[model samples]
Target: MLLSLEGLEKRFGGVTAVSDLSMHVRRGSIHGLIGPNGAGKTTIINLLTGLYTADGGAITFDGTSLVGLAPPDIAALGIARTYQNVRLFKGMTALEQVVTGCWLRRGVSLWASFIGLAEARRAKKATEAHAMALLERVGMAGRAHELAETLSYGEQRRIELARALGSDPKLLLLDEPTAGMNASEASAIGHLIRELRGQGLTVLLVEHNMGLVTEFCDTCTVINFGRLLAEGDPHTCLSAPDVQEAYFGRRHDADRIQSLR
Candidate 1:
C-alpha cells in the first residue's frame, strides 16, 4: 500500500465528522471516495493532508507514520492536494503560481533568493521549465503566461492540477476536481486523471461525479453520515443497497442516479 488510514476518527465539539474511517490505496492506482453531502469525505481529506488533526487513528505513507504533522510537513513527504474551490493566487501568472509549488524543493535561502545567487538563479530557471512541462501535460501550456484568475473555471482547475504536479508527488489527493465543469470538460479531466495513473501516480479522489468515478477509479469506498457504507469495485459498490439508499433515496430521481452507472 502507498497510503493507509486505520481507525480514523474526527469530531467537532458534538458533531462527528468522520468516525472509524479506514481504507487503503494501492500503489499507482486511482482510488475514489464517494458519498452524499456532509458525509465526512472532505473531512477525511483534511485529516490525511494534516489540515485537521485526527481525534484518533493512524495514517501511514510508505511505512512512515503521519499523525500530528503540519500541512507543509505532510506535503514535503510527497503528498500533494488541490482544494474543492480553486486556491490559486489571483494576481499571479499561471507559470508563477505553478513555480511556487516547487519552492520547497529549492535549496536557496531567503537572503540568497533575494540576492539571486548563481545556484538560486539556476534553480529558478529549472523550476520554470519544469512548471511549463507540467502545464503542457495538463493541456495548459498555451495559457502559462495568463493570470490564473482570468481563466475559465475548468481551466483554473487544470492550472491548480499543474501546480500540484509541480511537486512531483508520489500520492495526489484531489477534492472535487470537476465540481462545476460541464460534461465535456469533466470528461476531459477524467481522462487526464486516468492518464496520470498510467504514469505511476497514486491518486485518491473525493468527488461527487459518479459518472467519472465509475469510469476512472479501480476501487471505491462509500460513506454516509460519517460512517462507511460500502467498499469494493466502483460498479459493485455503486449498486450496493446501502449506497443506493444513502445517496438515491425517494427524494431523488432513482433513474438519474442509475443512468450515471
Candidate 2:
C-alpha cells in the first residue's frame, strides 16, 4: 500500500465529519473515493493533507506515520492535492505558480536564495524547466504565461493540477478535478489521469463523475454520512443497493449519470 487510513475520525464540534473511515490505496493505482454531498469525502482529503488534525485514527504513507504532521510537512512527504474548488495563485502567471511549487519540491531553502548562492541559480533554472514540463503535461503550456485568475474555470483547474504534479508526488489527491468542466474538458483530465497512473503515480480521486471512476480507477470505496458503504471495482461498488440509493436517491437513477456534468 502506498497510503492507508485506519479508523480515521474527525469531528467538527458535535458533528462528525468522518467516522471510522478505513481505506488503503495501492501503489500506482487510481483509487476512487465517491459519495454524494456531505459524505465526508473532503474531510478525509483534508485529514490526509494535514489541513485538519484527526480526532482519531492512523494515516501511514510509505510506512511512515502521518497523524500529527503539519500541512507543509505532509506535502513534503510526496502527497500533493487539489481542492474541490480550484486554488491557484491568482496574481501570478500559471508557469510562475508551478515554478514556485517546484522550488519547494526541489528543496531550495529560503536561506539558499537569500545569499545568492551558486546552487540557488542552478535550482532556479531547474525549477523553471520542471514547471514548463508539468504545464505541457497538463495541456497548459500554451497558456503558461497567463495569470491564473484570467483563465477559464476549466483552464484554472488544469493549472492547479500542474502545480500539484510539479511537486512530483508519490500519491496525489484530487477533489473533484472535473467539477465544472464540460465533457471534452473533463475527458481531457481523465486522459491525463490515466497517463499519471501509467507512470506509476498513485491517486486518490474524489469525484462525482461515475464515468471517470469506471474508466480510470482500479477500485473505489463508496461513503455516505461519514461511514464506509461499499468498496470494489467501480461497477460493483456503484451498483450496490445502498450506493445506488445514497448516490442517486433511487436505484435506477444510476443510469441517468453515465457521467456527471
Candidate 2, residue 244: the lDDT equals 83
Give a tens-digit lDDT track for model 1, residues 52-158. Answer: 99999899998888999999988889999999999999689999989998876787888888998998898889889999999999999999999999989999999
Q: TM-score for each prediction?
A: 0.95, 0.93
Number of the top-ranking candidate, with TM-score as the measure: 1
The lowest-lDDT stretch of 10 consecutive residues in candidate 1 is 250-259
Q: Taking the tens digit of each residue's C-alpha lDDT, what string does model 2 give over 18-48?
A: 9998998899999999999999999899999
Cα distance off (Å), candidate 1, residue 197:
0.7
Error of 1 at 232 (Å): 1.6
